[model samples]
Structures are given as structure tokens and as C-alpha cells.
Target chain A: EAGVAQSPRYKIIEKRQSVAFWCNPISGHATLYWYQQILGQGPKLLIQFQNNGVVDDSQLPKDRFSAERLKGVDSTLKIQPAKLEDSAVYLCASSPRRQSFFEQYFGPGTRLTVT
Target chain B: SQQGEEDPQALSIQEGENATMNCSYKTSINNLQWYRQNSGRGLVHLILIRSNEREKHSGRLRVTLDTSKKSSSLLITASRAADTASYFCATDAAYGGATNKLIFGTGTLLAVQP
Candidate 1:
């Protein structure tokens, strides 16, 4: 009965570097989501997956940000050539499948710092 | 941007006082939810109100959703210093069916003085 788990609670890298984050959703959850939050702002949706198939990713920066939910269980978010603006907290969330109203459980998040 | 926008942006009150925060959204939604985040970390789900419900309560928390006005309000009665954190309002504008997306607002920072 573990909550959503994320690795590398904190990360610091220089601009133009690359970083990856891993997430493990609660067991039996079928929906996964990744969000990016800037300082003093709310979290913004970067990508969503339903059973390993992407449901949305319109807000994702395709040039550098990429995420994949493998086998509908775990997910990984990667940012290559990270830019200064990409410095923010990345959050992962999950929910039960096909729920009429989403009640998502969130992870602590990975805080990325770009120098 | 169907995200709900929380008003005031920040609030500070002493322990045992009541705290009220308002949220407004531009689009129609099926439900509204509130979340609490501490220290810019994980967000904890607080409450969820369906469009049909006008008001709901949980312990010291009270939530009112006004679909007619596309707005909502959260009130914490006799709040404690431990309640200090950032509160956010999220809306799911799934009009036709299931969009499975929650649009979050900018959030309100609440600081409770002991």
C-alpha cells in the first residue's frame, strides 16, 4: 500500500545537461501523469498515460522533455539538454482506472536545479 | 486554460482563527478538488465536490461549489498552525465524457501563526 514513489528527490545539473527521473505508482493504478511546476506556480500537466498509451502531452516541450509509462505500471521522465527554464519540480501522480472523478495520489516529486 | 484561479494568492492568520479562500474558473466543470502542498513537495488531496453538490464538509474544512457562478470556496474553521501550507483548487472540465485531466490554479499560500 505504498504511495506513488519518485527517485532522486533532488537533482542539480548545469544547463544543456540531461536528467532522468523515475516514478513507481501505487499498485493497481492504471493512470499515470507527469507535471512540471515552476516557482510560485501550480503544477502544469506535461504528459498523461492510460495503461502505457499516451492520453495527452500537448504541454510537454517536445524538443527536450520526454516521458514513457512502460507496461502501464512505471514511468520515466527525461529532459535532454536541460535549459535554465526547465528548472522546476517534476511531479508524478496516479489514479484508479476509469474513475468518473479523478482522485490522484502524488509523489514527493523531483526537484531539478539548473546552474 | 480551464484552470481555476485562487484569489488572494496568500493569506496569514493566527491559530484558532478561520481561513477562507476563493477560486474561480472560466469554463464549466464536472467537479472541483482542493489540494494541499507543504514546502513545495507532494500535494495531498483534501476534498472533491461534484457539480451537483453545493456544499460539503470534512472535519474542520468546509467546501462550497457554485456551478452557476463557476466558482468555489474553502473555509477552514479554527485552523491550527500545522495547517500552514499552499492550497490549490483544481477543476475537471469534462463536459461530454471523461477527459481525465485536472487543471490546477496558481494556488494560495496560507501561513498560520501560533
Candidate 2:
């Protein structure tokens, strides 16, 4: 009955440094998503997972950002060699199914500040 | 790479007034959804309207979708200060059936003064 959970509500790191965020989706959720939201802009989908397999990663910056949903229950997003542009809030969301038209439940998000 | 753009980037209105925000997207979509985000929090789903639906309503919220115009509008009637937040519209592409990927628009910031 719990909502999606995320850790390290805030993070600060220098350019070229690396950081990782953890997320636990609601019980029985089958879809997980990672999004990046810049100041004054909408959240952009970075990656999506259905169960333990990836459903989409078309917008992910493979060279610097990586995410994995192990066992289809928890997910971790990592950013290596962080850039100034990467300073934004990272959001984790989940849905009961992989089907469309379902509303997503989101976590509080991790705000990253890259200097 | 944003798909939708909301009009009137920001709005300030008094409580009990009606606030309307419009969103226009570039691609065909299977459905459109609206979400709200507070100053320092994650987003909350407000409503979802399918492509076949021209209008939908929730408590104090009315959503109208015009697929022919690739536009949608969200109207909050008798708004309250607690309704102050950023409103965003999202869409899932209709290319090969509806997928889980959602494209969000630049949100509209609404402030309701009590």
C-alpha cells in the first residue's frame, strides 16, 4: 500500500563526479520509469522498464546515464562524469501495468546539483 | 525535444476564479494526461482523456481534447489556493499502438491567491 520511494532526496557533486539514486516502486507495480526534469521544463523520460526487462531507453544518454531495474522491483539510476547540464531533479515513477493510458505514481525525486 | 507547449507560461488568479490552461502538441497521440507538481515535490496525476474522448471532468477540473487541432485545455473551476502548482500535459504516441513512453510539455505555473 506504500507509494513509490526514492533515496538521497538531495545530492551535490562536482563536474566529472559520479552519483547514483535508488528507487523502490509500489508493491505489484509492473512498470518503472526514470525521468529528468530541468528548471522550468517538463520532465523528460530517460528510460522505462517493464518488469526486469527494458521497454524503452531512446532518450537516455548512454555515455553518461545508466539505469537498471533488478528483479523488477527496485531501480537504480547512475550518472557518471556528471555535467553541469545534468544538474536537475531525477524522478522515478511506476504504474500497475505496462499498458498505456494508466496514470503513473511518482516518487519525491532526487535533486542533483553538479558544479 | 519536447512534444507539447503550454500557453501562458504562468497565471495568477484569485480564489473562486476559473483558471484555464491550454496545451498544443505536434504528434498524434493515443491519449493525453494532465499532472500537477508543487514547488518542491514529485508530480501527481490529475486526469487522463483518451483520444476518443472529446471532454472529461473531475472534481473542479474539466479537460477538453481536440485531436483535430492537436490541442487540449484544462479548466479548473472555482479554484482554491491549494490548487496552486505547475500543470503539465503529457501524451503517448499513437504510432504503433499506445506505448508506455510519455512526452511531456513545458508546464504552466498557476498561482491562486486566497
> Judged by lDDT, which candidate is best?
2
**Candidate 2: residue A81 lDDT (0-100):** 86
What fraction of the reference interface contacts is present in each model, in order?
0.57, 0.79
State the lDDT at B33 in candidate 2: 96
* Model 2 lDDT per residue over A1-115, tens place: 8899999999999999999999999999999999999999999999999999999998999999999999989999999989999999999999999888899999999999999
Q: Estimate each model's TM-score.
A: 0.96, 0.98
Q: Output the number of the DockQ-best candidate.
A: 2
lDDT of 1 by residue, A1-115 (tens): 8899999999999999999999999999899999898999998999989989998898998999899988999999999999999999999999997455769899999999999
Q: Candidate 1's residue-wise lDDT over B7-67, tens digit each?
A: 8899999999999999999887878899999974569999999989999999999999999
lDDT of 2 by residue, B36-114 (tens): 9996656999999999999999999999999999999999999999999999999988887778578999999999999
What's model 1's overall lDDT? 0.91
